[model samples]
Target: MKEQENIIHISNLEIGYPIKGNINNTLFNNINLAGSSGELIALVGKNGIGKSTLLRNISGLQEPLKGQINYFGKLKNSYSRTDFARMVSFVSTEIVNVNNLSVFDLVSLGRFPHTNWLGKLKPEDVNRTARALEMVGMSSFSRKHINEISDGERQRVMIARTLAQDSKIIVLDEPTAFLDLPNKYEIIHLLNKLSKEENKTIIFSTHDLNIAIQEADKIWLMLEDKIAEGAPEDLILNETFNRIFEKSNLKFDKLKGDFKMQKSHHRKIGIYGDGPHFVWTKKALERLNFMVVKENESGQYIKIEKENNLCKWTLIEDKNIKEFSSIYDLSIHLKLQLKN
Candidate 1:
């Protein structure tokens, strides 16, 4: 019924870097963007398309070439450095290279804006650091050396540091990069939870389009000349994703909310089955360059039968039938039969 309050706002923003003769080398221009508190936004684009540059500008690490940014209804430039540090926290893609930094000490660095000139940690600061570590599930590693943990754990520590900063907005660059599947999912899920449960505004750049579409509250899609921002479904419905990501041999599958490889095929095979096995069977058939049909309208048909939890695949063509107990065997037979 009520709109979330805007935490960050941009208008007619131009982002770029300076080159020879003080002329700006523009990467993107004429942009408008806004993000609300308690929102998770994902920024995605092809490599070298300025995703990182845009993020740096937003985090106040660098000045925008043109236009204005407002944080909490105030001009971003109005804040003192320490005051700005209290307003936003940034987690960069750069790897940590501390020789012997402990996780607790690293997380404690987030409290610098509130600490005394001598950098003394008060009781509240210690408690907040503990809570930040707990939020990222890294409390057990607090006493561990930063270099001793896995890359994924180090990433979580960086996030925990942001949490400890206690800023209203958090910006991260490629937080899931260099992580395995489980770690990627974990980090994405943690960010989503933090946005909702902690009531923090989060913006991150990522290459994981599938996770972004599924988990982010909104998406900031960086194009070659401009940026597009909207809910994931809105972008899909407007065909924006297709405009940006579609190619001759790949397509965005709106129903599956992911990309699918397209292929040219001359053979058609009808598949009849049910459940997960059927789904995977169809996938395998499609990967083999077969045009998979649902009914027996085609001359060639495959039947997937499940009995007592064991699986069987049968191929029917003309007056001949071939059966196999495993998908590998079925695939081998099909390859031999359809090698035209």
Candidate 2:
């Protein structure tokens, strides 16, 4: 949906976990994903579905067994470790090795790409590191050791570090796993805003299905034996969600935007106006299981209501009729009527 050159492109990628027990089994096959600048995408998949592996490949931490990866349209293998570091930064869910480092020092690792051979920082780099810490709300804790912070705080610190790196693309693996509900919302909101304000592409793997569905500009969904990627709305409308989660016991409800028991209920009421008033009335009625009916009001007793005006419906009995004057009037009257 965004118009820009691709920052990350994987053509026929193949990935597999390198854990000791099973090092040969690939998660999925022949995968392709493209990420553009300023886009926020959720990398989603069921458990053991290769979401992390996919993230690893994008961050250049792992190589694809087959196919090619292009970072900023250049082949990934062509870039040296330093070149890769300059182009991408990652926040992994795996245990961090930081312990003795101060929060400031930890976050300054992001500036590694911009430093000299001895990794000495310039005044400009210092300013960028400070700003990065400030962006993630960790400025006050800059002098504290990273081990002194809570898991969620450490997560923010990692994000700050990524900001300092100033890479064109950032890859986060399970960023919200340690955060509480409100914190998760805040972080996602911040990430969304940052992606636009900074004009950097952001891709993160997440287990938060609801958040992914609600906020992501695009989604890479891992299905059993396969993977799917596209805009969230497009995937939902095309029933890709149902297939991805594939469970008879749990199902996706398009309207509710969640997995629930499949159900069908009907409402049978009808009458209306146009514009905001009509639109809202229909929604309210639908919510209450009322079937809305619309009809012509030529010679009929039906009347459509507007501000400073009222219309009676001739189709139904006046005693059980639902009517409204105007959008504003209707809101007030409905609140008052429902309040008691």
Candidate 3:
């Protein structure tokens, strides 16, 4: 494959934690990477894998046991601290404490590399900070203190700070860890927009596989024994990725993009009709039983109905027709019947 004309080249990278008795410990090996400008890349792996370690190595916070990172045709190690700061900025899972400082104050620190010795903001700095705040939708809360914000809000503030740095590449470690589903998507969307609109490179680590596959321009898959990197959908569709995260017995399903497990007891249920009918019926059955199977039940007609500007579903049990608006409500009714 031809190398991207404008890429930040990182070669032969190896990173691991230090230890005395654990002499043979290492995370990954011989990693060569190039992130292009205006691309969104995702770094993903199991929990104990070295995703953060790689990010820190590139940020120069931790030195790799062996390797080199070149930024704009210069060795990363050769750049002065100020020059390094000017080249890239970072956001991690670490929480900050600037109790009295408002959002603008926190973001203003991103301009320090370009500001005077007294940390006075130039007009350019003001414009950049304002734009960053507005991009993250934190402009309305500019005066709000960091200490008095939600985790999701704090996250946006941190991204705004990285934007204020005005660097070519921004590295974030699990920016969506603290977010719930909606906030998670929102933050990812904001980062993607920033990368395209500002023509900056954005790399972040995340456990959100579905979003990663749908959104990332590139994906770096870190496994226990080997590492895989490509476009998010490419790595996913090539059958190289596996599901690693789980809940209480919620095993990963690489095919359906959900969790599945064996049934304690199977469901004796019949489904009829087509289109939306099967969806709600399947949902109701799944919620009511450990496992649901479809067969022709002798007398019940659980089928579809479409009314004026609405979709309706009805069940004919014991020669009576009962209607429902949502599958979840149907599930609740089925759950009651299962109990009895």
**Top-lDDT structure, candidate number:** 1
Residue-wise C-alpha lDDT for candidate 3, range 216-326, written one tens digit per residue: 888888866667788865655666665444334545466765446534554465666566567656765666663444545545556666677776667667778788787
lDDT of each: 0.89, 0.77, 0.78
lDDT, model 1? 0.89
Cα lDDT tens digits, model 2, 169-282, are 999999999889977887787788888989889999888878888888899888886667889998989998888667655688898788755434343545546766566666
- The C-alpha local distance difference test score for the whole of candidate 2 amounts to 0.77
**Candidate 1 lDDT by residue in tens digits, 46-117:** 788788988999899999989988898888868999999999999998999798999999999999999999
- Candidate 2, residue 103: the lDDT equals 89
Question: lDDT, candidate 1, residue 62?
Answer: 90
Decoy 2 TM-score against native = 0.73
TM-score order, best first, reads 1, 3, 2
In terms of TM-score, which candidate is stronger, 1 or 2? 1
Q: What residue pairs clash in candidate 1, if any at all?
A: none
| lDDT, candidate 3, at 240 | 64
Worst 10 residues of 2 by lDDT: 296-305
Task: Candidate 3: give the clashing pairs.
Answer: none
